[model samples]
Target chain A: MSTAHTPDRPEDGRDDDPQDRAPEHGHAPGHDQDDRAGYKTDADAGSVDERDEADAPAVDPAAENAEGGEPAARVELPEEQQGEQEIPTFDLTLQIRRYNPEVSDEVHWDEFKLTMYGTDRVLDALHKVKWEIDGSLSFRRSCAHGVCGSDAMRINGQNRLACKVLLKDLDLSKPVTVEPIKGLPCEKDLIVDMEPFFQSYREIMPFLVAGGNEPTMERYQSQEDRARFDDTTKCILCAACTSSCPVFWTDGQYFGPAAIVNAHRFIFDSRDDAGDLRLEILNDKEGVWRCRTTFNCTEACPRGIQVTKAIAEVKNAILSRSM
Target chain B: MSTPLKASISVPRSKDLEVNGVKYNRSSSRRNNFEMYAWLFMRLSGVVLLVLVFVHLWVNLVSPEGGVEAVDFAFVAGKWASPFWQVFDMLLLWLAMLHGTNGLRVIIDDYAERDRTRFWLKVFLFTTSAFVILLGTLVIFTFEPCPAGADPALLASFCAAG
Candidate 1:
């Protein structure tokens, strides 16, 4: 539950005002020209930030106090790239999490100033960073069209596939911060370890079980039957839905949304008579019961898969005691 | 200091279900295997669903015969008359329901954070899905397509053949 405090102050390296009392949580040094601290209560942000917004960074003072005592320490802290550097020429700025396990001592964010079309995607920015700025920056990518579902990452506190998110759709005034997915261990940069994710995935017996002898020839099925599970069939195994889940961050064992989306693909097959066995498997404590339905998966899904709908279908199957 | 017991128990089944050639162990989390397999089921079923779904779409809406209007009670009876359609429909029913329910399971876990709330919500979800799946399966396999001494219009084309 405890997070390591990240020492990497904001790009605008300004320290605490030193005038107002520093609360329990360390005030994050952000870009601002004021002497006031952003350490007020969450409720005070409206009143306090109202006067400080133009001159200071966009932050709620009281919001920081609630988390209490400094940023959670990440294995890699934000670097103290302090003091004013020459702001680069660009129509926009990109603050991306940079890591090269082979070279760098630790992962850190690197800001880039670029002149890009409004419709460019995070993937485009990353491509620019890798090719023009730093080839050492690593991330997974395939089927640049987004169908491969490989480029999923946390964008501005939300998990999304990089190829699918258009940069222009984001708030431009602030630096577009990006990081690897939360919960799983970081592999290189922007890629989390997926072993545990797959462990939960492969556990559900992803196969067709008719409960009878396996059919040598094609198994029989009707048209009406196929139409029912049509929607769940679109999942592309991308971890976007899974990483979007908050519970997944705390408990690595909790089966996440993408894994369940995969299971849903099979559980609905009529030719597979393994309902009893499948139900028994899914009935576990961390099974279908862990989803809190924040709609994050649905929002983050790159395939436009009706993730919530599929989850509903699975819930219906689990709640039915016949299993 | 009291350390929690790390003991585990498992049920031995005839054929172990595995995904991606990996065996599913229910012991690690000390949690039930319910959600684990539900996640797996989505992937597995999603695969088979690709085939079952395509053929189904091809037969129902894309065939040379008239579409949409050709479906009705009598149409259902006609299709059920063939064991192929019966088995196919049954598979679709089971997979879709299970897939759908597993998806809902994730929703429950994500949204229903409280213990009591999760428990009751799952109770309700399991009960309803079980009831529907049971009734549906029973109707599929044991469906009677004919009635004796009934209105000629209501009977199947071959109902009076007996």
Candidate 2:
């Protein structure tokens, strides 16, 4: 009888009639165990029927007799699958650094207390505050996942993606501090001017520059050559690696790790012919040489790109080409 | 409905932004290989200094009979008496000074924001480094370990013998 309950069931509650039990259990009217099992119907049918009776929910005799049939079987669902499962939730406090030049010249910290679920991320908490508590809370985010790279911010002094950082992983005993990524102008709360980061990106010529005619079909590349630049291709221009840099914090002119990583992508592509021009561009004083190899960029990259290693490779390329 | 508030202030785009009162101007490339050579020199000299400095320390301090206490006027005089020792000390002095100066030069370039401030700081650094290097070279070659007019007790034991 346990086999009577097929996994397929109409999600809508249309089959709730007490008389509709036959089709509800995947059986036609008058279909016996022999017809249903199709194999060992003679030997095991009685035991299956007994177990099915025992597993059925306890029903009031009066209600059953009054209705002239057993009530719909209420199958006990697992704890996690139950629609009414109690999700663990807790009160989360977010201390956000608020800066609005229009409001005032002074920067202040705003605290927001929100009830959030265990599975909720820092981005969820921010959304809760924005949607429910205060609509004035401002920040930039897209895709709501790690891919778009739009929600990169500082969580407790380290650069991280808000959407990627789950609330449970953070130290919830204290207020989670959320602030804007440093070394860029903070236009408002959590939003910074991204033009400088993109300017540096533009300086490196972050595109394929082939001298010959464009390929008719596609430029063919070996697997090994593709694999060489595969790591840097994951960059979403998040600027997390660049802002976390101490050198970039001082000098905005420095190409920063993101630009160099983008350059590394095309530099080792094996098809691009403008490697020399790129090398000359990055050979500037404010170029790859400014990278102090602090490993901050490596730690801050949400995409897990090896930023310092790429910068070092560029430096090595410059050295080899020059010498 | 409440009217939207107009922004009383505006921030310049990042390319035109100022950090620490200095405009964001990337110094154009000089089209020279000076920085590359300086960077290479730091790495090479760092490795060489590791050997040179440790050997110098071991000979003067750790290898002596009484460690640091064994170092005196006579010990220094004995070491400088040899041409090989003179050349070794000279090389150490030059490399170390230049290495330190270049490291500081990079730091000044990194930190000092204003053009005039960077210029003055680098000028001061170069002048001081040049003075020390020149003075150190002169002392290594022209050091009179056993001056004739000095008190015999203050001089090295070899001076009394002479």
Top-lDDT candidate index: 2
CAPRI classification of candidate 2: incorrect
lDDT of 2 by residue, B70-162 (tens): 887878888898999999999999999999999999999889866789999999999999999999999999999998787776677778777
How many angstroms is residue B24 displaced in model 2 relative to the true structure, after the best TM-score fit?
4.3
Model 1 ranges with Cα > 4 A deviation: A1-90, A102-105, A211-217, B1-162
Fnat for candidate 2 (0 to 1): 0.25
Candidate 2 residue B64 Cα shift, in angstroms, is 2.7
Q: In order, what lDDT does every prediction score?
A: 0.63, 0.74
lDDT of 2 by residue, A1-323 (tens): 11213222222342342222332212221122121122222244355445434534553222332212211222222223234344457776899999998989899999988887644678889998889988988999986656578999999899998876767566777899999999888889999988778878887778776655566778899999999988898888989999999888885778899999999999998988767777877887778877888899988887667899999999999999877
Tens digits of per-residue lDDT for model 1 on A70-105? 222222222332335321223668888877667875
lDDT of 1 at A51: 46
After superposing candidate 2, which stretches have Cα over 4 Å from the reference?
Answer: A1-83, B1-25, B156-162
TM-score of 2: 0.78
